[model samples]
Target: MSIPAFADISKSANDLLNKDFYHLSAGTIEVKSNTPNNVAFKVTGKSSHEKATSGAIEGKYADKSLGIKGRVYLLLPTCHPKKGVKLNLTFKQSAFHGRAFFDLLKGPTANVDAVIGHEGFLAGASAGYDVQKAAVTGYSAAVGYIAPQYSAAITATDNLSVFAASYHKVNSQVEAGAKATWNSKSGSAVGLEVASKYRLDPVSFAKAKINDRGVAAVSYNVLLRPGVTLGLGASFDTQKLEQATHKVGASFTFES
Candidate 1:
């Protein structure tokens, strides 16, 4: 990064002058004159923070999962008579496995949820559905809204909640639910999630207690005949939530 060629100074209540994070991106989108009906792909690469090497344990950085992320999105143009704009789908992916041994313990029992941010999450927990026989997992998904530079929301944009789901697999049985998102306020990112899950552990006993709301089970995983990585991060959220509540855990991608 170079010394900024430009600067925007702001005054605080104390009249003290403070400099904000340096300017990195120009907030603009370009549309070609050729194709108007379709949206195309776009990519941006920048350094967020820098550090060197090793292992996965907890959060994003502290455990050694620090590096730049390649971000992606879709672009669309306004038509001759059309009002407003259109956006193609977007997604975020990471290179390591994430872990959370502690239960969200308590929160909405429903199986699906969403939050406004760069990553949408999915999750499910079961106390002891079945040991050596049952496997359970939670699931969630979210799309980061108002990219930081283009939209002021990066600093304070309620990320639009997109979609969510949760599921479990045991023996030969799979139980899952689907969810949708909605936000009444245009400039803000708020959404509702809905879903349900049913489980049967016997590999032959594909049945749920019918009376159970949210499920919990004992889960343990090991991957490296190879490597390890760990990163830790936390944030203070200022979201206006719907009376329907949710739990915030980690985003996950896995392998044997």
Candidate 2:
């Protein structure tokens, strides 16, 4: 097993609680296509009841060790066509991976990250430098161990003010994970979240998660066809169930 990047140290647990849940107030649609020349294209459109509709177009090309990706956002109402472009370059090898990102819209910022793994152990760090301010804005470091069926990681982020630890375990049909974080600067309460995913069948799965903030969520995903997937999810405020503030969302994706 290969260790993930610093930002992805808790990816398994985070994905179970966040990805495909899509508990937005509106709808989202995504389309993807791949070409024989190793180029991939994707378009995503989202609708919001409180704001105008928005979309983005992304393209990527990759080979054995190098990859490049670009995306342009379509801001509604008044779109600045050129300012929304973002670019990313990535390189990967058996024991090392690196990435660079450029955001043309926000401070026209650039960030870089690198990770190295060997013998199931990993170490990585990331830094973001603000081009406008000409100073290092933020940085983080992480260390972890990955195995065939389980993984553990610890990280210090926010300029070392926040520390987090996570663990994930997987079996044939069940996946479970937990994460905890504490902020040294505030010396406040620790934040905790746990999630689980269960494979209902070969084509479908269910996920559920809860946090210390009295919030809970559940989601179900099913493959309707060979290249089509559907996801439905809902979230609730356990402490204020009578407030009628719960949310439900659905998402559809197609790939070819």
Candidate 3:
């Protein structure tokens, strides 16, 4: 293969790093046009070596209860050596004592899910099967019992992976949770994670997590404006102090 230029190599490296490592560094811009009625349009662009852009048009029906969305993407030169599309539909309805939600996603990999819940209890199941690849990519069923003071759930996927999690409301401003997961294919012990969230006030909150791999992270979020928010996050490896990462991100929303 021919050698690549230094600038080209650097750009490609940054593109991959930003895309996979940190969204804050990806340089993404999104614009949603002000429109009337139930129809809306949005366009987004990301600066990377690949130079990717996408456009989406969505519509609401049934008194804004039903939504249909479609997206098209363009990656200069190539996107994964191929071009693809995604279409999704969301429907929500009042069910039992709470609500029911259904989502259908069609794209390179197709998936569907349904969920129903009331106040503090929710049950969900989802499946994703790729016919062209002749593989089952996703399968899981989960049920959660949540109360004002406690919550718990367990999930199993394809009978190969299992996960369990629980949370407790410590007080009005603080909550704590723990999670455990096991993957049969990896032959690893159950991964454990302990996490907590604290709300300093209505506009600011903080989160921290420590996982089985001796990796820990803390993040804080604050609202900068009515429709704008800012986040700062940092992670460190407890076993290796030198292995650490930090990220900063800002999000914006516009309404007519």
Candidate with best lDDT: 2
User: Each model's C-alpha lDDT?
Assistant: 0.22, 0.82, 0.53
Query: What's the number of clashes in each of the models?
Result: 30, 0, 0
lDDT of 3 by residue, 1-256 (tens): 2222211212221221122222333244445554455445555444432444443333333333544443344434444665334455555465322222222333346666666666656677777767567676767776665554655666666643765444444577876767677877777788877777788999988877778998777666676766555555556677887643433333333333
Candidate 3 global lDDT:
0.53
Output the lDDT of residue 163, model 1: 26
Reference-based TM-score of each model: 0.15, 0.85, 0.59
Please report the TM-score between candidate 2 and the true structure: 0.85
For 1-256, candidate 2 gives per-residue lDDT tens digits of 5546567766765676567666664678899999997778888888764555877777776674543444444434454455455778777788987889888778889889998999988899999988988999899888888888988888899987899998999999999999999999988899999889999999999988889999998888999999999988888999999997788878899999
What is the clash count of model 2?
0
Q: Candidate 3, which segments miss by more than 4 Å at Cα?
A: 1-110, 116-121, 130-138, 168-171, 243-256
Q: Order of candidates by lDDT, top first?
A: 2, 3, 1
At residue 124, give the lDDT of candidate 3.
70
Sort by TM-score, best first. 2, 3, 1
Error of 2 at 7 (Å): 2.7
Error of 1 at 180 (Å): 9.4
